[model samples]
Target: MEKITVTAQRKHRDNLPTGSVFGYLPRVVLAAMLASAAVLALIFSEVVRGWEATISAFAISWVVPGQALSLGQVAYFGLGTANPRGIDITELCSAVIIISPLLLLAALLLLMRRFKIGTVFKALAAGFLIIVLANVIRIVMIAFGWDHFGMAGFDAAHQGYGSAFALLAFAAGMIVFIRLSFGRKHKSQQ
Candidate 1:
């Protein structure tokens, strides 16, 4: 029985999804391309910012503690706050940047892995959801910080823990990407 299992492992080794350091090249390249595209898009496209800012403002309004009024790309928080100024949804805070890594992984996985089409798509959807949700949480954190602690809290959440939160989200998305890509169930025979 053990011999038969060993034989099976040997036969399937070539098809195993995970590999060496170079395997991550797709992830890195995709991330860079997405980041570059984000910069270019922000510079050239008002339409992009229009939708993003609206989305950001609407989302904050839905969840923020105080009443929030959204206009254009800024979300104004009210109720006698220290910094009456609202938060602006900037190019840097684009969800495209947060989700680029996972989407790129999905694109490259098409060549590197023998995943079922359904599985690949599930990963893509899940990846988008994970990163987007994380970004929303980061935004909410900033809003909450600003609402409570004024500019100091805002700075702490945005400059201090905001980055760390985003990094953790990226790490989490990568982990999910690996698991979905390498789902160790019966091969779909694709």
Candidate 2:
């Protein structure tokens, strides 16, 4: 009779799936399912309903002083200005849209079994923070453009240059996730 080494047994267990479903399901299929579920949850959850206002307040405060955030309407107001130019933040402009896809991508990577769950989760967190910060910068840029120049400037920033920058930021985030999750391993010298 052969005895199994404790370390070898532990390694085998580590490679096994956490549940029976995960064990038998194909990785691609699992990734698709997880991605769909995550996106749907984010879309339907009230937990993030306040994100628009929160992001607006942060961006307004950073870009202009004494700017007040209005509730319900989801807009910002300038102090003492008769015709204060404010940006009305909507769900489309919120970071939720951008963050959702990135999260989906991360979840896909996790389910695909290319990387350890811990590593995927950490990278996902960092990527989310990066996306959120980029969104803030985009909002501030729009505000500054509107303040300095008007609708044309705002349009240029919002629809033209800003969109490109957003795409770049998102791509950079994806690249970072890929590098972190699939980084090359170096062989140790014997």
Candidate 3:
């Protein structure tokens, strides 16, 4: 009889509505989504290498004058045909790493708002392009600065302009996400 009573009590305790486990679902999903994105980005990095070659060829032909340009040349002014002062990939990678997380956070916010998946993806893609473009420009500027004032100038640009541009890109991405998400709704409501 005691065993039965204890069993019943245990069952009752077990059956008493367990707190929702789904509370963490959103966070888990967000983490998984971001992880998957990062993995895919890494996988696609190889593909980007090929694309980079093509782009480098094109940039050399159209954008910058003189002989074929190298990544180091374009990244900074010290290497290759760019100038004696090239920027290099380390600075470019640093800029990308710093800016990418902010952009990702902004994207997650838009995603959490229940925006359409397609819209979110489009916004994310646009944001990435903006960052890439801005980074390229930043590298160019750093290279030019290095050419003019040497490493000190390059370092200054990295600290000041690079940070400012990253913030601007992040803000721009968020703004674009918000605008894209709500603009349709606003028009429909009107």
Candidate 4:
């Protein structure tokens, strides 16, 4: 049998498919397409519009002691307060909005040859879970603060603390994904 030289092996590897979408196309073209797709997902998010209410309902149900009742998109709370509180679940309060951008960024990363599709999927999955959990905690904090300390506490948690926490969680999740995707391993040459 003939021995294959390192140059020959390198050439063979170069010819093989990279497994990216439109890998045969120019990298710049592919990158632009992927970026545009990501932007479009945010622009026309019909599927994601109602997800805020659904996810909030599920999260509120999980956080509260009893069943958290949602009439339409509003979550009703306050057991023995002067009046029952209705927390309206809006796009700003939903995890789906935050998760969508991450997913799009992952797709862009895949297109730009930063990592494999499997890595992107894994990262996106983990990020999605984190975002959902963070959003739930935010809502809970707002509701609990409102019930206990009145409007000031609610505003502080909703406008100040909870929003910051959610943004931090999203950033942390994305950072983890990037590290997992691009962290290089060195192979010792014999």
Candidate 5:
């Protein structure tokens, strides 16, 4: 009798109520859906571009201190000097290009339900910060190139290795997101 009862108890202990294990599911799903929808809508909006340009303007100004800068808003974001010939921050050149993809990826990771919402958020915050800093650095470098190298410098910095650096930054952010979110579980499982 004792052996039979022990075996039954072990079987029950092995089975977990799925509901209890997934207590955080609702919040995760809601967050993932909201982010995915917003990301899609922002694709056709100038809000992100404007924000990116504004941020870049402030960053570049800080880097080149003392120069009078101008920002063109309403339709698109064009950051230039007082002379009017500045770099136009188009959608393609915007940080949105990289950040969007990562945002989508983070949403998908959230939907997977393997991580807690707080962990996912922390990972995303760190990753986005890295990408933003990299982008600012890229813009600052472009301004530096234009100041010292002229149009040739601008062309090289904007379309050359500068773009490559931005891509690398995105890759780094993705890695950080995955590692931070999943690493916790992987260790516990082992």
Candidate 6:
């Protein structure tokens, strides 16, 4: 049994010839090409399917939190009372759109080991919660804008405040990760 095991090990080592350039560049290139293709396909689909309304719906939904939050914002501000332009802003479809990118970014960072697995995951959870809270705030701001300054103000809040809120969410995630890393380091030193 020992002799047989030795023979098998020798064979395995021999099969992988030294200095044989099994390059990873080709695989990396192929992966990048595929990712680019997928992104292009998604963009094309969105463009072909009425991009304007699709984008607006996506952006609004992400910044509006859940159903109850949205309803409360609308009721409190008295903005979506009669439905503007026959469009109900009650549905929360954009949350998925906004959260998907952040989740993907977090997963990629975790997989790449940019941070510890546990730390990255916890940071991602915190980030998601922050994003939800920010979204609620954004909704309230937009509702108030619409109530006071009409469509122009609503549009401005959607574009400006929504972007700021999203950035805040991202910053929150990074801060969480950094804090966890620092805490871990400090504990190790002690």
Error of 5 at 129 (Å): 1.1
Q: Clashing residue pairs, candidate 2?
A: none
In order, what lDDT does every prediction score?
Answer: 0.66, 0.68, 0.52, 0.67, 0.68, 0.48
Ranking by TM-score: 5, 2, 4, 1, 3, 6
RMSD of each: 7.4, 5.4, 12.0, 5.0, 5.4, 10.9
* Candidate 2 global CA lDDT score: 0.68
Tell me the TM-score of each prediction against the true structure: 0.65, 0.72, 0.54, 0.70, 0.74, 0.44
- Candidate 6: RMSD over Cα atoms? 10.9
Best by TM-score: 5
Expressed as tens digits, the lDDT of each residue in 52-99 for candidate 2 is 556666667766656657565255645555547666656676667777
Regions more than 4 Å wrong, model 1: 1-49, 62-66, 79-84, 187-190
| Model 6 lDDT per residue over 5-80, tens place | 4455357657654553343333344435544543553445333223323333344444433222122113322334
What tens-digit string does per-residue lDDT give for candidate 4 at 1-190? 9874576547766876866555645554544665676566567654453455455656655544445555665777653446567678676676657766776677677665546566666766777777777877788888777766789978998999988998898788777777766646666455
Model 5: per-residue lDDT, tens digit, 11-119? 6656736667475567667677747755863665466666666677676666553443435522111234443345666776776776777677777777665566778
Instruction: Report lDDT (Cα) of residue 52, candidate 1.
Output: 57
TM-score of 2: 0.72
Once all C-alphas are superposed, what RMSD does model 5 give against the true structure? 5.4
Which residue segments of model 5 deviate by more than 4 Å?
Answer: 1-25, 37-41, 65-84, 185-190
**Lowest summed lDDT over 10 consecutive residues: which window, candidate 3?**
72-81
The residue pairs found clashing in candidate 5 are none
Scored against the true structure, residue 190 in model 6 reaches a CA lDDT of: 17
Decide which is better by lDDT, 1 or 4. Answer: 4
**Whole-model alpha-carbon lDDT for candidate 4:** 0.67
- Report clashes for each candidate as comma-separated counts: 0, 0, 9, 0, 0, 2
- Model 6 lDDT, full chain set: 0.48
List model 1 lDDT by residue over 62-138, tens digit each: 65655666567666765354446577767677566555555556655655445544576676677667777777677
